[model samples]
Target: MKILNFHIRGKMAHFRRYYSNSSALSYSVPPRTTLIGLIAGLLGFERDSYYGDFDPEGCRVAVGVCSPQKKLVQTLNLLMIKSSNDLNGSRQHHSQTPTELIIPANIRTGFLDYEVWICHQNNDLINTLHTRLEQKYGYLTQGVSAALGTAQHLGWAESARIVEGEEVAEAQADFFSILPVSNVISLHLSESRHRLRLQKEDMPIHFHPDRTIAGKGNFLINASAAPVNAKVKTAVRLSDERFITWMED
Candidate 1:
């Protein structure tokens, strides 16, 4: 049998290559961080679990991860018109990193018993996304095997939290700008809304979207169409498509 050699970062690099012309992402932690442990815990291997030791030396394996759909922008405390120049000044800005993941109420999960909130200041997308999957997607992924790069496929969500009043330095000058905008809808690994799974027999539970007042035509996003990176932008575009599909369904 042929063993598959999968590099977590390398796979993301492929995605980046494909979407580079649209949107690019900067990860706080590489996708490989949880892959090794996932393989060990899932295979029940006590020691080194090399591909050749179990499967084959050269096989084709697919890898994936649950990522956030947002971008980092410099914070400038200015009116919308005043901030127009801030957008133009981003030609030489550093890459933005993902800050957190957003999980909706248990309505997405069949149980509808508990409201789970997992916070991460670091690379928490993995954990948060995992929780959403287990609760909302009928636990499609399991054990340590369900990790970045080791899993059969990857997933993502678009809902996010906004960090306003954050300070970002530009040209050695301090400016307060809300770097990323959090979208109302998030992506989950389910074809149907998890809320629909609740049987009529189950106890009554009230689940609704968190209310927010915003002007029309305003959606959350991290980056714009100015830069040319398809991969980076694909995630957002995919999220939009998913939203449209969900609404239509």
Candidate 2:
């Protein structure tokens, strides 16, 4: 399999959970939909135009947390717009909303890092995407900028390149990326360097042009930014000897 690999580094990130009602809570890591949106933004894809193309049938994506992270809830002053005329806050109406933000665990000398791997069936599209990222990482120019959920927390792509990998039929192996529940047989949580906190989230799988989410799936992730030693059904072994489970898997 041919995959484009890169790391997104930022000072802060906030991926709002799908079911967050009043307060803006965030996911520990960016979900698959968020990953697709990031790639689309870099490629300058129009709003809601490329979701289908990045779906499971057209392309595959896998993301792994490369750094330890933590969440903080802050009260944000937001405009209380009652109508279109209130958009400018002319009425001096405002609301305090609790917003959750994610940052590096060791904020003193670390940044939020997410390793992204994407493989597309269309050769031309994949090649173009890789070129765009390569220019971004190499020349620090070309392509649009990347942001973590909010535009204020801007991010950049680094170490972007193409990689070659082959599918492995290993029944049980350690995986460095988030694993879809359907792809896992079981996890060996007993053997670990520290306490493990496994959490599952119901994330949107795909979005439609009509502004409605089409599919959703549950995924498991390690909150401590550590690889999960688990039994897996299938995976891709990259040339760097790293194993990853696809988001669609």
Give one digit per residue, the lDDT tens place, for model 2 in 84-203.
998777867577889999999888998999999989998787788777777743423335567888777888778888899888775566677888898888888876554566889778
Model 1, 1-249: lDDT tens per residue? 111221221111111111133233232222121233344343354434432322211111112222222223332232223356656544444444322222212223311011111122323333433443434433333344332231322422223222111212211111011011121223222432222111011110111122121111112111111111111111211211211000000
Q: How many residue pairs clash in each candidate?
A: 24, 0
| Model 1 misplacement above 4 A | 1-37, 54-56, 64-68, 71-249
Off by over 4 Å in 2: 80-91, 136-144, 193-195
Candidate 2 pairs with clashing backbones: none
Task: Name the candidate that leads on lDDT.
Answer: 2
RMSD of every prediction? 22.7, 2.6
